[model samples]
Target: MNNAPVRTVSDAKRDFYSHHTRPINSIYRRVVDELMVEMHLLSVNVDFAYDPIYALGIVTTFDRFMVGYEPEADKASIFNALCRSIHSTPEHYRGDAEAIKAAVSGMSLDDLKGQFEHLGEGGEGLRGTLAAIAHREKFKYSRPFGIGLYTLVEAVTPPEALKEKEAVETLFKDLASRLNISPDKLQKDVELYRSNMEKFAQAQEVMKDMLAADRKKREERKKAAEAVAEGITEPVAAAPEAGESADSPD
Candidate 1:
C-alpha cells in the first residue's frame, strides 16, 4: 500500500520545541537576566538598597532613605515589591516578546526610565519597570503612601478638615511641582496614596457621625424613660430652645 510519511511522536516533539518552546524560553531567560541586572543597578545607585531580595542573605534593606526604615513593615514591603516586579515582567514584554527581548538586552534601568520620560509616552516596560524605580526613588519601596505629602497636608489642613482628600491632593500637587519631579514619576504614587487617604478620611467621618448619633439617641432614650416614670406628659420636641445653635449637629 502506498502512503504518505506519518507524523510520529519524535516529529511532534521536534516541531513543538523548535517552533514554540525553545525560542520563547531562550528569549525569556535573557530578558529576565537583563531585568535582574537593571534592578540591581537601580537598587544600588538610586535606592541605595544593597542586597537584592532574590539573592540570599541574612536580611536585606529596602529603604530608599536610611532614616525611614521600619523593621516591622518596610522589610515585608521590600520582599513584596520584588516579587511583584518579577511576576509583572512578562506583562511588560507582552505580545512583542521577540522585539522586547532584543530591546531589553542592551538596556539598563536608566535607559528604561528614559523610555518613559514624558507623560503618556512609554515603551514596553513602562508601568512595571517605572513602578519599581518609583518604589526605590520615593525613599522606600512603598509608593502611594506619601508620608511627606501627609505631613504637608496636616500642616495646611484645618483641624476639622483633616479627612478631606481633594484639598490635600491639590496642595500636594502644588508642593510636588516645587520638588521638580515629573508628573510621570509622581502619577502612580500620588494617585494611589490620594485614593487610599480619601477613603480612610471618609470612613473616619462616617465613624464620627455614627458615634455622635448613638450618643444622642441614648441620651434621648434615657430622658424619655425618666419622664415616663414621672407624671410629665411633655413631648420631646415641645418647643425649640431660644437662640439654640443652628450650627449644632443632627
Candidate 2:
C-alpha cells in the first residue's frame, strides 16, 4: 500500500482559515465559506480534473462576490489561501484565466460561437479544452463550468448585443446543444450568474452612497466644531437691551 497522506475537507478548511486569519466581512462570509467547501470537495474527487475554465470560474466568482470586501488586501490573501487549501497555485489560475481572455480578445460573437461549434479545430487553448470536455463521456458539469462559459460568451459579444435577450438566449441554447450539455440548466446557471452580478453592482453603489454620506456628515461636523471654536474666541456685539433695537443710540 502507498504511504501518501489522506486529505479531507476539514483539512482544507483549516488550512484556508489559518492563512486567512482575518475575519471576513459578514456580508460575504457565507459566500466565501461555501466556495471553499465546494472547491475542496471538487479537488478531492477522483473524477474531477482541473481545467482552465474551472480556474477562470473560481477566480471570476471570487472577484465578483468579494467586491468591496473590507481590508481589501485580505481579498488576495483569501484567494491565495483557498487555492493552497486545494494544493493548487493561485498564480496558475490567474494566468490561465488571462490566457483564455487573450485568446478570445478580439473575436466577434460568431467567431467565438464557431470555435465552440467545431471544437476539435480551435487549437490548444480554450477550444481544445472545450473539445476535451465535449468528448468526455461523464463530464462533471458544475456551476463553475457554467460561469466559465458565460465569461467566454461575454468576452466575444458586444455590450449592445448582450442587451438582446432573445439573441443571447438562442446563442447559449445552441452552444449547449453543440456541447451536449443541458440547455435548460446551462441557461439557468448563466441567468443566475448575470443576476447576481447585477445585484452586486447595485449593492456596491448603495455602499458607495452610504460611505459618501457618512463622510459628508463627518466633514459637516468638523466645520461646525471649527465655527463654534471661532465663535468662542471672537468678540460678539452685546444683545439689544430689553426692547431697544441695536440700531438705537446705546
Candidate 3:
C-alpha cells in the first residue's frame, strides 16, 4: 500500500476513507481485511503515540473498516471516548459493532502486555500469538539519535524494533497456516492480546534479538570494509632510517 506520509492524521484518515471502505469480497479477504481495519483504528486511537506510517498503511489496507470520525480529536486522550462511541454507536452504523467494541473498549497496552505475559506463564495458544503480534505492531519503537553511540541510542524504529510488523503483512498468513480461522469470520486477535501477551512477547523478543544481531554484524562488516578502503588510500608513514631503531624495546 502507498502509505507514505500525508501531512496529518486527518489527511491519513481521508486517504484511507477515500481509498479503502469497499464491499466485502472472498472469505479470506473479509476476515483479514476486517481484522486489519479494527487493529488500525484501535492502534491509532490508543492512549499513546501511535505509528502514523503503519496507521496509514493499515487504513489503506482494510479501507477504513469503522473509524471515520476521530481524526480531528486528540488521539492520545480519546481512548475512553472512542470506546464509548464504539459501544454506543449503532450496530448498523459500523461494519461490525461487536468487533469495534471489543477492539476499542477492551484493549490497552498494559492489559495487552499483561495478557501476553500470562499466556506464556501458563501455556500458549492462538490467543498468545495474536496478542504478541498486536502489541508489537501497535506499540512504536524508538530509533537512535544518530550520535554514533550505539549503546546510548535506540536505533531506527518500530520497523527495526522487530524484524518487521507482521500484523499488517504476513501475520494473518502465519495464523492461517496454524489455525482454522475463517477467512470470512472476524477474529478475536485483539481480544487475545487484551487477555495475554507472553507468547507474543517471547516471539517478538526472539525475532528482535536475532534481527539486532544481524544488524550489528552488518554494521561491523560495513565498517571493516570502509576501514580497508581508507587504509589503501591513506599514505603510509615514512620509513625510519636504517640506523634508527623503529622498535626501541629498550
Candidate 4:
C-alpha cells in the first residue's frame, strides 16, 4: 500500500484559512473559498500542467475579484494562502504573468496573433507556449485557460478597440481557430468573464456610495457631540455635501 498522504479539498480549504488567519469579509468569503477549491482540484489533476498563461489567469482572476478587499494588507496574505494551498509558489505565478505581459507589451495585434500561428525556430517564451498548445491535440482546456486567452487579447488590443463587439468577436474567433479550440466555448467563457467583471464594478460602486453615506452620518454625529460639549443651544450647520468617496472594504 502507498504511504503517501491523500489530500482532499477540505485539506486545501483548511490550509488556506490557516494561512490567512484573519476573517475574510462575508461578501468576499465565498469568492475566496471557491477559488481555493478550484485551484486545488486543478492542481491535483494528473493531466494539468502549470503554464505561464495559467499563471496569468490565476493572477488576473484574483486581482480582479479581490478588488477593494479590506485591510488591503490581507490581500497579499490571501493570495499567498491560495497559492500555498495548491502546493505552488505565488512568486512563480506572479513572475510568469509579468513576463507574459512584458512579452506582449507594445506588440501590435497582428504581431501578437502571429505568435500563435507559426512554430518555427527561435520560437521561445510566449510564442513557443502558444504554438505548443495549438499543436497539442489532447490539450486540456479550462475556464482559466479561456480567461488567459482573453487576458492576452486584452493586453494587445487598444482600449477603444475592445468596445467594438464585432472586432473583439472576430479576434477571438481567429484565435480559437488557430488554437484548434472550440470557438463557441472560448467566446462564451470570455463573455462570461467580462459580464462578471461588469457586475463587480457595479457592486463596488454601490458599496462606495454606502460607505460615503455612513461616513457622512458619522461626521454629523461627531459635530453634534462637539456642539453639546460646547453648551451651544442652536443647531449645528449641516455638514457640506462632498462628492469625494472612499473605497469600500467589501
Candidate 5:
C-alpha cells in the first residue's frame, strides 16, 4: 500500500465539524507527521522508524517522539513532566507509551561520555548538537566536561598520583572505582584526549571563519557608507599627502 497520509496534531482532533471516518488512516498520518515534525522541532538529525500501535495510536506516537526529544539540559524537569503525563494516560495506552521510552534507555554513560567529549569543543558541531539537545530532540552526552577534563588530567598527572603513594593513591583509587575502569587503562588511552583536542581545533577553525566573514561584511558596509557620503561612484582613492594639494595635479 501507499504511504499513510501525514497530518499535524492540530489536524487530528475530533470536532463538531469533522469526524474520523478512517480512524486508522487518519491516526497513521497524524502519528507519522507528528514524529517527523518533532524530529525537526527537537533538532534530531537522525532518522527514526515510524511505528504506531493499532490502539491509542496518536498518543503512542507522541509519547515515543517525546523520549529522545526531551531536552538534555532540562532532562530532570522534562522527565518529571514526562512521568506525570505517562501516569495520566489510560491503562490501555500505557504499554504503547512505555515502548517509546525503550528507545531512549539505550543511551548509556559511555555513549554519553563519548558524544559529550566529542561535542564539547563548543564549535559548530557542538553548538548544533547543544541546540538539538536543548530542545530535547538529540542525544546529548551528560558528562562531556567532566570526562574530558578528567582524561586530560589523568594523561599528565605525576607518577606519584598513579603509584601507591599514600596521599595520591587514594585519589587514583577513587577515580578508578568511580569510572568503573582501571587507572592504568585510563591513562594509557591517550586517544580520548586527542579526540577532544581535535574537536577544539575544529571549533576554533569554524570560529575564525565566522569572524573573518563578519569582518568582511563590516568592511563592505563601511565602504558602501563612505562611498554614499562622499558622493563617489566607487571606493575613494587614497588621500593626498598633507602638504601636497590634490588640485596641483601630481
Candidate 6:
C-alpha cells in the first residue's frame, strides 16, 4: 500500500464555504414566520407571501424608529432590508404586465405562495430574477411603496417594474423630510386601519347571522299576531244561540 502525505498541497482544494451560512434569506424567513403566526392568532388572514413581507416592513420600521428595540446586533437592519426585497412588487417589468397588475391589485397570501412555489421550481425565468434584484435594491431603504394598507402590499410585491415604487418612495421621502417624522409614527395610523378592517370583517360576519335570526323571529311573531287577529275576527260563533228563547219563556 502506497501512502501519500496528508499535508501535500494540491490545486484541488475542498472549500467548505457554502453560500448559505445562516443565510440572509433564512433569517428573513424566521422573521416572517414569527410575524405570520402572530397575525393569524390575531384573526387576520396572513396567507400571502407578500403579507409576511409587509409585516416585516412594519415591524422593522418600528424597530428602527424605537430607540432601544434592537434584536441582535445590526441584524435587524439586515433583515429589514432583506424582507422588503423579498416582498417588493414588480412595477412594469419584463413579465406579463396584466398578470402582475392582477396579482398586485387583488393578491392574497395564497397567490403569493403560488408564485413563490412557481419561482422555486422554475428558476429559469429571467423576469422573476430581475424583479428579485429590483426588490432587494428598493428595500435597502426604509420607504415602503403605496398608501395605507396598500403600502403593505407594495412592500411584498415581486419586483417587475420600478416606476410606481420609485414614485411612491420619492413622495414618502419628501413628506417625511418635510415633517422630520420617522416612518414609525405612521405605524400607529396603519394600525388603526388594520383595527378597522378587523372590526369590519367581524361586523360583516355578525350582521349576516344576526339578520337571519332577526328575520326568523319577525316571521314567527307575525304568524302569531295573524293567528290572534283571526281568532278575534271569528265572532265566537254567536255562542250557539243557546236556548235563550226557552229560558225567556220559563
Q: Worst ten-residue run, lDDT, model 3?
A: 144-153
Q: Please give the lDDT score at residue 139 for candidate 2.
A: 73
**For candidate 5, lDDT tens digit of each residue in 50-102?**
22111223343344323322123432333233223322223443454345333
Q: List the RMSD of every prediction in angstroms.
A: 22.6, 7.1, 20.1, 10.4, 19.4, 23.6
Give the lowest summed-lDDT range of ten residues in model 5.
48-57
lDDT of 3 by residue, 83-162 (tens): 23323221222323223223324444334334334333343432443344344434332211001111111122233543
lDDT, model 3, position 122: 41
Let me know the TM-score candidate 3 reaches against the reference structure.
0.23
Model 5: number of backbone collisions? 3
lDDT of each: 0.40, 0.84, 0.35, 0.84, 0.39, 0.38
Give a tens-digit lDDT track for model 6, residues 1-250: 6364322111111110121124333323444344333323322222222323334344433343332222345444443433333332223111232334344455653453344333333343323632442344223222221222234344445445323645544444443333233445444444444454456557656655766797799999888788878884453433335757534533
Q: Estimated TM-score per prediction?
A: 0.24, 0.81, 0.23, 0.82, 0.25, 0.25
Clashes of each: 0, 0, 15, 0, 3, 12
Displacement of residue 239 (Cα, Å) in model 2 is 33
lDDT of candidate 4 over 109-139, digit per residue (tens): 8889888776644378888888777777677
Position 125, candidate 3: lDDT: 37
Descending-lDDT candidate ranking: 2, 4, 1, 5, 6, 3
- Deviation from native of the Cα of residue 250 in model 1, angstroms: 78
Candidate 3 local distance difference test against the native? 0.35
Better of 1 and 5 by lDDT: 1
Cα misplacement distance, residue 184 of candidate 5 (Å): 12
